[model samples]
Target: MKLLSLLVAVALGERTLRPRGRNWVLGVGEQGPAARPPARLPAPTLSAPAVSAFADPAGALLAGLRRLLRGDPTPRCEMSRFVPLPAPASWARSLSPEASCPRALDGEWLMVSVSGRDLSLSSLLRKPAELQPEPVLITMATAVLTVLTHTPAPRIRLGQDAVLDLSFAYAPPTPEPAASLAPGPPPFGLEWRRQHLGKGHLLLAATPGLHGQVPAAQEGAVAFATWDDEPWGPWTGNGTFWLPAVRPFQEGTYLATVHLPYLQGQVALQLTVHKPPDVSLTPAPLVWATPGEAPPELLCLVSHFYPPEGLEVEWELQGGPEDGFQKATGEKWLSALHHHSDGSVSLSAHFRAAPVTTKHHGARYACRVRHQSLPTSGRRASVTVEVAGLSGPSLEDGVGLFLSAFLLLGLIRVLSGLVTDCDPQEKVTASTPPTF
Candidate 1:
């Protein structure tokens, strides 16, 4: 019975584990068909923070999920992606936050909230119809999400709470142009004349509102003659010039130019010349006295016609005779005497007597008179005087007489004292004794 039980156990075990033609089963009784290969799992997607250092894991995941469910297309999840959103309808109100708020749009809040949701990349790209392809918006939204999630946000200071106030500074503008200095009329017109009173006399005058200023001692501004084109006066002070006495030069019209300092233009005047009054000598033959032991007298008479009041006259002896006598011990000759008065002049010669005599026979003398009115025109006369006799005895004659008288007196005294004594001294003495 034990042998039979062993055989049956062996057969059951063989049935449980059967091997195919060349393959035999050892440990397990029978093996089903070879185990099929295990299925391959897909690679795990990276979290937002793991993929980009700047992304926020929770926010990025939420946004990606929201984008996937809303049939929105997923954008490049890289931090480098940037996009711009549509212009807000309330842009004007946003610009001025201090002012009153304006009305809101219908889907403005929904659109902004949807932009914050997370989305799966594949599911979000499946429906391109429901999702608008706005590359700029997607890029901008991704960039903003990335910065908000991974970077520390900066705080904005608004209104009066801000620390520093800013403004622009500028300078004031310049003024416009204007005129300067007061205006007036030009200088007054001037006029003048030249009169020839004498060789050295001149006169000038002007119309109203014109006067004469003294010329400089040095050469003043050059003056031109009205008639001729020549330059005149830069005259010295000695040259006589009178403004009130302006008259003509000769028998013709005279014109002159006068220059005053600080004057704008030359002064011109016209004058008519009139014939001057005639002057003559009363005693036609001007007689002169001869020079003698005593000075001789010279006399001359002059007469003037239509003589002006306060007419001044002067007399002078121009020259004397060519061979008039001269003394060895005194001046060669005496000058002719001169006499003058209101309108007439008398030329007189007076001899200053000296011890010496003079020979003045047939000596000629001249008398010259000058009138104040007619300075250039004057009268001159000459006369001849005869000087008689020769020179007197000299001092030598008196000396010779004195010497002769002295010699005669000496001879008489000598003869009286001497007597004719016969020769000896003894005989002279005896005669005197016998008489006594």
Candidate 2:
């Protein structure tokens, strides 16, 4: 009975102490339950002192931690587990020699020490711990450090092995595309009038229906391909072109094109070379005069299809062989001068002295007309002036003769002894006779 009771008690105790169904009980020699993994603790928050100590190597690590934290959706405690501490050497090098040790205690304050100098937890912990490693934090911290380090601040200690490793988040800058040239609306349907200037230049003037906006720059070289032309411009503000001289040997109409860079368009112009016209000058007959006779009235008439605005008329007397002659002026003369409106300029003047004696009679007088527009063209006329007998003398001529005679007599008296001379008187003989 006693044995039965004891056996029953042992069985009951085993059942009570063992785990529920499917549980395996290990004897003393059997292996124990697999060791439970060590409970993970949250990463320690670096105190101001520790942060200063680790600054040299910890900056990169802190930045990484910040990145990881920013990416993590978890709360602070969970995030700390994912962000592990950086390599000790990298952290140590980042820290200054005087900021070598830092500690966090009671989750409220950070104690810092450098070169045996103590810095209070409150003083170093002015900024929130979460702000560390952020861009703004580093900027602010550097500024604060600059101000603080100048004063009697704690010193940091660093070993030769310490190094700071930093990697910046950077991206290449994007490039912008160049601006396109903009040309405004072109004129509607209209035939353009083309006028030829010197060389390869053709002036395209706007006709009745044609209109054009002036280009920004006026001068430039044009480039044209068979199919298309584009103006690659460093255009000038003056719309002028200087081109090589064209040859007239070719018989066909030459097709030419120009690319206006500023206007961003191609222009077509045509040139036709032809022979020049025959040009000649012929003068009309002239009236004749004599010495002491009335001056011959001179008139010249020129005929041409186109007369330029800047025409100048000039006359020269035809003396034998000698080219010297006086330029005729509009001053008053012995005879009235007249220039008729029929394109003929005339002059009438009395000849005080005959230009040609009977010996050089029928000499030619030439008149020339010049202008700017007609460079290769001019008008010339010639007339003959002959000496003939004079008409009756006038009162003016008689008075002139009387004055001439009076002057001649006065000159003879002053220059010669004929008028002032007296006969030599005989010497008085009274003194000589008394002596005798």
Candidate 3:
């Protein structure tokens, strides 16, 4: 218990002293390194000009005019410095103005360069200095732009409507060096340039303006670009802009590019439009079986489909004692259907009976297919079930029957010979028989 109390006391002490040590660490308190004395700036010298009342009055007037002209205290001119930022994926920096406009971070920040000359007269009072202008350059103001584009591919069906999305938000420039003082880069604007969506196979309906008002006529290119004249350095704020709804009539890849005219920076994205699958059902062949054999399972083929490439096939049986042959629901009756390499699916239903009886002899088996293309009545195909087996004597049984009949006829003939002609040679002696 004593050790625990001691640990608690130590923790409290640390907590209490931690705040006071911050000043020492920052070099602000006496506990820290001694602070360096501030540098001394030269003081401007002022002395009454020597003016003799008897001197030339005209010279005094000229001197007074000169002093009044320089009285505004040389205007401070500072040079503006621009730091080349890392180029974005689409924009390039350090290019000649004619080559391409430099790009700023999308909705993030824009650094501006300013050039000015400092005209402080304090130097004139200290010593005779060269009459050259002092120019200072610095990156003073930063403009921020927010860029947003449709994520992923804007996927749609060939005939479906797709809206291309590209938008940006421009935040007010950072307050630094008075807004009126900093001369930033030329106004930056974003506009849609071109589309490679086939040869007019895709049609665009309208190009919307900044106020969500569409233009009078449909345009091939859409621009969200607008100029800002607030002297805030040509940065315009556009909340959101949508590309005209486009209907793709072809199935292929398409691309669109949005550009920042001032920076020559562009953002491009690719869109994919797919064709709906063509679905078809093949006629299921008739199922046949023997009297005591299992019926062959029936198959209905759904072919020529794409994109999804697979479909569901159902089996419905009709014509049994209950006025309908109920489809088998057990797992044993159905086989899992898989798509072929060629993107075709074939599903089959197995029909079985412990001992196939005549009750299921004429049942009709139909396969109903389900796919995007085929509608209600057109997806079904039926095949009749037939039980046919040959009923005829076997070769071994026929041979045995023929042999038995022949043996019986032979026996009858032998018996008749013994009864009527037993003694061909002694048959003529009728009197001898009588005497015996």
Candidate 4:
């Protein structure tokens, strides 16, 4: 109990305090509404001049003015940041305008970023809110995307989504007492990136804006958390994603990467996808075969499997009530592999079963399969076999005897008729009378 409590306490950081009702503002020239510079915003909104979230607000404004000199729509620029409204000066400090962008915890936090920045723009403009310049292109280079591992880690289907939770509420930034008069850096999260998933990184957890969000909330004090004393920089968090519906061709190995500026630590992460097969047994072929003929055989059809290799099928037999199932080795042989258009594979297996016998009546035969995608015990199916061995000579054997006797009698009668024909044809006495 103590250990669990301690761990929780450590993970939770300082709970940020915020001013209620008012939203943060972004703009050029701090005056009128912009004149009121609060330490933090409850939930900030853009005023007018605060539309831009660039490091060089004044310079960006100057560039916008030049574009307006020629055309209303400014020259195209990339979306560099989605820094929360009323962004603290610390967010811009030591951070390059081109290096990365500020993203929210929730993957669906688009509305939050827009609303906050717009509120700040209104405030910064002070007068009638005018001249709103938005980013033309947003690169995913610094965008945090969804991170996915192999299914069956928790187990999911190929087309099923692997979703995650990465959401949180945080306090706005506050101006520091230092000479720079710059507000502290906004909270940031740790994220993971992959090779094929575009330039987006995977959101991890907690904010490191001022103090670590988790540690702050858990310990009830962000100031005294372990981050303060730790050699690595502040904590970061709020990341999530779900992969697009995957297909069979998409199954393979992948590499994942995460960037940590402070620690320079890298994780060797990889993912592999596998699809299991469906197995079935057929005993109908052996059901009607004569005992003296060919050996009884069972067929095991394996289909819809992946990688198209390392598949094996075995047959087992249980003869009589007292006998246990035994492997019918040397009798199992696999047929050629057949590839499916859907990127799956199939195989046929023939197992020569034991000869049918009266003692083996009511026996059971089973087909077991082994494959990379299957569990340790693998998959199997079975069917009961009933065999009453050949009893007496068949009807064909009796018919053979009857035909033999009839053929012998017919041969004797034909020989006697031949003898009578030879005597009559000679007629020696009739020849003598004619001579006298």
Q: Highest TM-score among the candidates is held by which one?
A: 4
**Model 1 local distance difference test score:** 0.25
For residue 215, model 3's alpha carbon misses the true position, in angstroms, by: 20
The local lDDT score (0 to 100) that residue 44 gets in candidate 4 is: 28
Clashes of 1: 22
CA lDDT for candidate 3: 0.36
Off by over 4 Å in 3: 1-143, 172-257, 261-270, 275-436
Ranking by TM-score: 4, 3, 2, 1
Which candidate, 1 or 3, has the higher lDDT? 3
Residue range 1-436, candidate 4, lDDT tens digits: 0110000000011111122222112221233222333223222232332222212112212222232223322111111122223212232223223234333221211111111211101001111112324652211111121111212122334444443222211111112233443343233333333333344332222334434322112111111111222122112223333444445543322222212221111122233445688988886533543444434577888888876778777777776445887765436778888988767788988887645555555667778888877888889888766553344444565687788889988998999899877895477755765544
Please identify model 1 stretches exceeding 4 Å from their true place.
1-264, 268-296, 301-358, 368-379, 388-436
TM-score of each: 0.19, 0.23, 0.31, 0.41
The 10-residue segment with the lowest total lDDT in model 4: 1-10
Per-residue lDDT of model 1, residues 1-436, tens digit only: 0110000001111112112232211111122112222111111221212110111111322333333334424222211111122212221112223233222111111001111122211100000113345442221011111111110111111111111110110110112121231222111212222334533222232221234343332111122212111122111111111222222222122222222211111111222222223333323243323344433444444443222233333333222332443321222232332322322223332222232224344434444445544456565555543343323333465577788788888877677556543446767667675543
Off by over 4 Å in 2: 1-263, 266-283, 304-307, 320-360, 374-377, 389-436
lDDT of 3 by residue, 51-160 (tens): 11111111211222123224423211111112323333232222223443333222222211111121111000011112323441211122233233432246554444
lDDT of every predicted structure (CA atoms): 0.25, 0.26, 0.36, 0.38
lDDT tens per residue, model 2, 252-312: 2222211111111111223332222122222235445554444454544433312223445
On TM-score, the stronger of 3 and 4 is: 4
